[model samples]
Target: MDEAESAARRLAWGVHNAVGFVFTLFWTAGWISLALLVLLATRRRDVALRMAARCWAPGLTGGAGARLVVEGADAVDWSRPYLLVSNHQSVIDICALFQAVPVPLHFLLKQEMAKVPFVGWYARACGMLFIERDNPRAGPRLRREAAALLGAGHTLCLFPEGTRSRTGVVAPFKGGGFQSAIDAGVDVLPVAIDGAGDVLPPEGFRVRAGVITVRFGAPLATGDASGAAGRQALADAAHASVLALLRRSA
Candidate 1:
């Protein structure tokens, strides 16, 4: 696809996005409610997360006609917890990751997500930490929460770019997630996602049914890295790794 959608594609996109978005909402609501109830009743967050990855996520991505291709997953040392860092491309990235990543990925979500109805409940129940990007004062608390989660052996994933790019270019990495990684002394796993933007662009959650590939890169050590400098360096290194993976996949 070019920078802009063609007239013919635009019409198809409208119908696809409208039906897809509505379907996603109702589908998600039903699944999330079931998961939430199970979690609330039995206090099993793992069950909820599993339902999401196994049932809800596939519906979101595959139901939209997005096919996934995963690479370098075997290279990952899944035995230990590492902070997952990936490029932001499209709304499908989340569902794609949920489908691609072998583990139940706890995402660093924006604080505004707390206000979102079913999603908010799901995030909290699953112990996915909220990122208060707009409030600098929330850093220490966030880092503490993040470190606790990591120390407890939960793998986390976040798009350091903060948001999806309209031009389909990878954006600069934000420092918050990296800082959390540094504080926890967790290794950073760099992931590259290609063709997701084409499958589902920024204009709307349109379905293209294209091949979306997720490439996993080697983990960067931040075990001994310290302070603000460590965070920035780790973030830069991870960003570079993601870019290289994208290039290789291209």
Candidate 2:
């Protein structure tokens, strides 16, 4: 691209971002309150999940001028529970997955997220799972919580890299979420998300309009994984599957 075109793109991104920031703050708060209300009134998670998958999530990505295209989600049996593991890029991955996947995701979040004001409150109110990654003693409790959530047929999402990838490259998967998957005895569904970081990079809110593709891979069974060694193996397999999905989509 020429210098003129490059400068024009930057100018467009800046103008759109100014509007997007305001829209995000209000749109998110409104949907969150409504989701909480729906959960409270209906006493059912599927209702909230439907709203997110159909409306709120789509609104977030679409509002950013991102065209989201999903594939392979239809192959999975949504009736059964899953550990929806995916590659992390930026916060945009959350909205993309929530819309791409046909279910509500109870993310296996960091325990610190439990303190993020309204977000934390909504997560707690909705019974989302939070892992204390820094606390060694939290294992048994976490395992029990994972089992309960999975047993209740909740699909939990986890970014096994544990944090966003600033370089837009998939990092090595961490073992904690894999251990939880094994303990819970649910299948690990590998999801690949491409191009989200370009839309909203890890550094800050500077945005771009782009296409984000979310592709799902076959679920990896966790029944055979037994010890710590087995957990590492599962994480490795999940990571490889995600990489393969990215390659396929690319």
Tell me the RMSD of model 1 versus the true structure.
3.3
lDDT of 2: 0.85
* Candidate 1 per-residue C-alpha lDDT over 116-191 given as tens digits, one digit per residue, 9 for 90 to 100: 9999989988998898877889988988888888878888998989898888788888766787677777789999
Off by over 4 Å in 2: 1-12
The digit string of per-residue lDDT tens for model 2 on 1-250 reads 9999999988887888888988988887788789889888999777876776787788888888899999998889998999888999988888898888776778878889899865787788777888887788997888788878887788889898989998978999977667766777789999999999998888889777899999999999998998888888999999999999999865
- Angstrom error of the Cα, residue 233, model 1: value is 0.8
RMSD of each: 3.3, 2.3
- Model 1 alpha-carbon miss at residue 122, Å: 0.8
Locate the minimum summed-lDDT window of 10 residues in model 1: 1-10
